[model samples]
Target: MKRTVFIIWLLACVCTVRMDNFTYSYKDAMRCKEHICRHGYSYETFYRVDANEMRSINVDPHSVFEMHIAIQAASNGHIVLSEIPNPGVSDPVYEIVVGGGGNKFTELRRNLRRNAKSSVTTPQILSPIELRGFYIKISEDGLVEFGREGQALPLISFNDVDPLSVKYFSFAAWNGVEAKFLYDCPIPGDTSIEDIPNSHPEEPKLTPTDKLKRTLLMGRLPSVPPNPVMEVKLGFKLTSFRYNTLDSKLTTTAAVVVSWEDDSMAWNPDKFNGTTNIKLRQGQIWKPSFYVLNSDGYGAMDSTNPDTISLASSGEATLHFQTQTQNYCFDTTTTYSRWPHDVYQCLIVIEPWEAHENIKIEILDETDAKFEMFSDIDTVIHNEWQIMTEQVTLDSAMWNEIIDLINSEEVLNTHLSDKMIITVDLAKNPDLYNLVFYVPMLVVLYVTVLFGLMTAVMANVLLISNFGEALGKSSAMKQVLTCGVVRAVFCLPSMKKAANGDYSVQEDEDSSYIVDSREGVEEMERSDKEIKYGDKAELAVVVDKILFVVYLIVFVGMLAAHY
Candidate 1:
């Protein structure tokens, strides 16, 4: 499965090349007042992957060319469509940008400067498939309007005071997306369009596919359960996911397939040349729109691809709702408080936006298992976190009560009568944090306490000369420091002598830290009259014992909290 990529901005300097694959149908035109307006000149082309590609049609006013063009493109890349009145010189151009630089907006620009923008209607404009159509019109008064084929209002509009006549019309796709642009669509009465491959013919007889759709009342909704709730199966095919630690938001990318049976839409294969399926788009038949109950302020559950609804001859209509969503994670404080070792459970609640008394929502039994299996092999960062479990459950009663509560007060709202909740169990991987931060901190704390312990135990011997002589010069200490066997043999006797106030050194091994015996015999005479760091230094060394105990306690507490 493809992993979700973080949003990136595209530079103006991004280079583009011409696409090599191009297929065209007959020139589509309708006879207008002064000239012929081309309606459908279909072109199917494949853009090179990741290499920003540019394509254009030169609508020279001097020649007999189409002034208006319709484009139906399928892509999830940055699209910059511009019209240059003066083609050669690159200034003072009108531009229409969609999904620019991976952001989700449609912009209208003058001279490459943004004038207005709106939310992009389509999602997953990445891959080129199920091509849908739109129209762009350049009015006579330097005004431009663009919208989907049948949309009443233009999605993008720009009016220019100093406008030039439209000449070079171009569109470019950026950032590794392969795009398909279909244009020059035939108007209602263009017979030449029939020559195009797969162009639906005006058949005199209705086929089995047509008959089945007619019987099912393709555009209407199915009736509610027949004294029995009609169950609709919903399942998720998770492609990838992303989590933002800063915002505590989780974005899930899944192909949510919904299936239902409409008996009238089905037919036996023997009567229809073994025809098993016929496809439809979103609005052509009754469809359900799923919404995220926990939107986290950016509550959008949009279809990545708006095309491709499959209907089997059995009257079963299945739609692969390619949804990409950004949701607010719940109970994050209770889940994320433990830092690197934290485990969180986020419930992604999905509810059918439409309310019906007869329809019921259901969760596929294998949904959790399938999601877990996909998580294991998905192309996400391996050592970051794990999707410990995935569970999808139906919550009809809960949603019903919630809807009632929402409707109790005087307010206008649209809520689900039934809902499906997917539980995602998440846990962080703590290995890297432990190795890089926790272990080093623990070692430093322990070493500090150990140094304090040694200083407190041997202050007189190792620091000030209060315990008669240095522990370094004692025969017993030398044996302990140099040889393990010798130290073991003399360990009990040395301890016994120390208890008797005899931290004494052997004659041959006698040494002092205060002054050297042979070279400082005179210095020792002066040292008898002068003392450096006497009682104050001894008192500080004695406090080390107390501090050592306190330090050990703190370190123990720190360890307890860590685990």
Candidate 2:
């Protein structure tokens, strides 16, 4: 049972290469207007494993091609694989063609459907077992192998075809017909039919004599694997604490060091079934992994070959990577002076897939990989004296406690299982500060408060006193006693221009001229008396202005003390 479980687990950890297909059909041809794939007559076939990485299939003159080809309904068109120096030119191109019985090179039945459904169900040189489908493979050595799609072995093998005649290999077709075709290669390095089958073992294997007995009994081998499982690792960490702060970005470096012992007691990545390719899963919010090692020693993760991370004869290998976060100087949620206080936590993470086939991995977080963010709000404090000072500090223990919680295993697992979190709480309003710096200004403000209160009381008494004339005269004279001589001179009122012309018009429009003249003399005397009272108004305005100024100064000073 233990062996059974290990086998199951190991099977799950295996990662396979993706197979690419080149198809030919009516709808596809219309999309490819120029009979070209993606603007090029031929596509540069490559597969992407990550956003920053891609693996391409290396095909040279010696490479061979094998694929399953099919057709929907009988048509005049044919499937052609050829090399074209210039795609448009019809010059005698080196090519291989497959079609129904009418062709002179290789003959096939006219009605492929009838032949495929016949009782014999056997592949032949002139008639393939399947009506609309067949299997074909061409080697660089001029060997062409052809058979039915589901047949056990090749029905016919043709030899002696020169590969040098064609410069490049491409798939194309003529006329109209519905068809399907795709390459069988999946992983980058795999090139042969046997390599794929052995690498991707889908079914349980049987002894040779049992397999022969089964083939004799059923005439075919089983096509599916018994069990399939996928394996993945836990997580990765930051090993270095030395972080660099450049402008608005914060950068930190980390490495994944994996080691193991072999039968010869030699430690290496290969000894542990390690490939140059190391697959990693990361949180979406985190930045893409930046490979650290340059192109040297054993191939780094960033190498053109991403399959391995190896050490040069050393016991262990290190896969170094870094994370640089922007706007790291300030909380993303809060900027300087914009808010009173803010706290933020930014995470850098990397995790690999589960282990299988005796492969083991180790993740390190030596730096603890975390830091706290505080602004001027945290540094400056409003003291009991209401002065904002830098002497204030927060409890170091509280900060340590928070850090401990962050580094805990539970929290780490929570983050790895969920999306990454980068958060900033809203800032609290800070205490407002004062701009007062001089002692005289402070003393003057206090004196103004007392003086203004006294003046207000005296002014109120005069308003109610019926000692109006005396109060008015004293109010004007008081400016002199109040110290500033220049201010006193400026406070003196000017006759400026009597309230304009309406009085002259009133005199001219009088209906009883004689009586109006007698009353007008009396009215003129009253007007002079009113003008004298107007002077009292001017004095009141002056006194009110002084008191207002004094109150303003006192209010500012007191507010500063409280802050």
Candidate 3:
């Protein structure tokens, strides 16, 4: 049983090997032929071990088996071997023409020989059996070449086999030997020869390739264009002046009213809102008006030349005018001394000769020229007016010359021509004159007298020699006198005491006495209480004793002189 099993396993192995070595169809075999032919136009073939069959036998898709087979060719129609063939022994010889039946054959054969000789160890050529099917052609010239039908060049192998290892049997035939030759005759499964050309032709045309490269070499970009320009025009005028005098030191009040317009026809109001357009127009006119106001005073009135007005691109119009006036009242008064006083009430009228849009008037007086006055309605409307009349008092004796001059025919005649009117009446309160003019003067005089009396009393008190004595007698008197002296000397020089006691002569010197006496008294008191005695006392006593002895000596000398 063991032997039978072993035999069965060996037979199975053999069957697998034979099956793997099964010949591939000529069409299928052409795949390998095409692969090797891609290396060059021509090559050599040898029968040794087949690498193609080995792939099937191993059932290993990645199997790499090669056989070492040598091939050599010469530029001349001869062959050379690296190692000498068995001496005197006949070696198989063959001749091959690559690319036979085509013009490329000669060139192919030459290139194959050149490349084979240049290689380090000639590469092995796979046999035609391993390649499936190949064509062998014999020419009348005795040249033999291998190829596939319709191929431009022959397919040749470079060595006997893979030149590295072998996996199956392969074959090569001598030129004159009897060997089976295979042709790639069309079979049912074979693809049409025309299809082959359609599948792959000569290297693709490079024009389109070059064109694409050029397009990529350069690049893409963008574009630009042109635009427009703008133009503008401007106009100006003054608007209005706002006077702010409450926080300022201005003594007058006035208003400057101005209006303006933009006359530029090109100005598009639609571009601006209604309010904005109005504001812009006003601004154009008023700006110039404001500039004028800044250059002149608020009340300045002047005419601008019509031609000076400018028109802007926007259509608008403006005009400005000004007038100023002031109003105030003042009082006037006068006095008289006698009867027969003639007082005159005169009506004075002033008016503008030309019609004015506005007018103002001002009057000033220094006398109590009492008179009735009111605007004459009609006269004012006509620009004519008068100073109304009222009775005024005058003392004929005191104002005799004035009354005479007023009564003169020349004056009366001049007034009548000028339409001046005058009237008079008896003085009502003659004392009013004195009260108005003299009362304040009398009050001032009385105050002066009272001040003088008080000053005299103060002076008398300050000058009294017994002031200090009086002060010593009564505290009240002392304070009064001291206060009086202080007031006279320092507070009120008007109340200064007159020259009386020694104090008067020494007043200038006595000024320093108060300071000096106070200092001296303090020093004397300090000295009297602060004396010290001890060892210092004994020293003082010794000094005194020495002084006493000196004094005694002096006294004796004086006595001697007396004797």
Candidate 4:
């Protein structure tokens, strides 16, 4: 009895199984190639990344492309794409490794650089003896995703926001491994879907069960979007926010609640047992393509995307996602001015991968764009960041592709463009910066100013000379910049350099700082006639008073700009 109950429980769980790309092709417009022999098999190409020779193909930036790849070796194979086209017979030398570690493990690379420390692992995903089908999708917005026969999301994906146009591609295999490729569209005459391992895998028809999937997939292909326009309602909540002072990056974690109505799911109640509701696995049905325009990695391909959909007999479908994105702060310049008091506003753009003509994203205002949860800032976020509930907003925006497609046609432009923007407002906790770095620096600054005042009043030349030569004073203050503390450390150098109006302390390319005047110290022209010591003595006093005023002006200016 326990074993039978366990089996029933397993059947109730959802599995995200998305269909391959073949469904995206228009049914009426899809015309098969003519007069081709199925067994000719002459068109099939065999190559390897580990091998010396390979095949190159061109990619379109404005369109979506699919590829069928088969590798027998469990842990090895290669798919190299070059953004920079080659000079004549050779392919583009610059390559992005989309798939270097076959089915069991794979790593995406930017030229020679590795994307992450961990490899994407799906053990024994490919059969050791037979060719298993996988689809590589190259879409607009610089998104590249590959789906295996049985997987929830794209197994290997990469996205570059301002993506490079793929101009060349090649297949290579490490020495002992050889991969089979079937690149052209339209299979040869009368070929079975199973034989062509690179073609779209046929969808399996199964009865409804809670664990593996649903009956809605029986006669429909969810991978294909509805014609004309499909409206998707979005509910967004920013669950987490953190900023890295070092990387100048804001790590944002959010939850998006989405709902839409699918016409195909409208079933009659009398069918059986008042079948009014069904909850299925994600991969087995059609779900929206969620992409973050400013994602640090491949947009929709990352872990934050969702698949679970709840379907009501009335046609309403809902899905949920817990997303974390490493985002670039649009307002980076403000960080330096505000410091502890800085309020950071980072833009999070979410959109469908499909064009505007196919899908539309509608942001619901209530569930707070679904952002209302942020109002209780004390609970939503735990970092040093203070969530500004009032400033948090969600609005409609346009995708880069749609923006480029826009022109002077005002009337025809209505109901076009599909994008949603979420702006997260967060303030720095001043208590720490005020207590740690700021207070100490303020103390040193005032002490140095006081010393300058005394020396100016005394008119002591020897004291002024010591002040310029003292490395001890400036070194610690210079450390206030702390390397990429970005570029130069705004520090107070020696009284002598200040005297000459040469108060420039520069950080070297390697992040090491140096104190130098307009003239080099070692090569410094020190002749008394050239130095005019008495004149400098008078100017140093004036410079000290000017610096005090300059510091006040800068501080006030920063406050005015940031608040």
TM-score of every prediction relative to native = 0.44, 0.23, 0.13, 0.37
- The residue-by-residue lDDT of candidate 2 on 298-362, one tens digit each, is 22233222323322223222233332222242445335433233323333322222111121223
The residue-by-residue lDDT of candidate 1 on 1-563, one tens digit each, is 12323222122212210111111223332221111112222111211111011112322232222222333234332223333222233465556655454535566666443544334543332224333334565554655665554445776776666654443444455444444444334332335533221111122346777776565564565433322445677776555667777777887777666777767566887777677888875666655566787866444467766656788877777776567777877555655577777766677777766555435676654345433433443333444667754646545666656657878764433443466777776677667787888778868877877877776666544445634345445565444433434334323212222233434222233535534677655664465445322233433433454566677798788778667
Residue 165 accuracy (lDDT) in model 3: 29
Arranged by TM-score with the best first, the candidates are: 1, 4, 2, 3
Assess the local accuracy of residue 414 in candidate 3 as a C-alpha lDDT between 0 and 100: 16
lDDT for each residue of candidate 4 in 40-105, tens digit (9 for 90 to 100): 112122211211111122133343444444444333455555543222224322232333454456
lDDT for model 4, please: 0.51
List model 3 lDDT by residue over 212-330, tens digit each: 32332243221110111111111111121122122211111112222223232234434333222222222222222111211223332333322222333344332322322222212
- Give the TM-score (vs. native) of candidate 3: 0.13
Whole-model Cα lDDT per candidate?
0.51, 0.34, 0.29, 0.51
Error of 3 at 141 (Å): 99
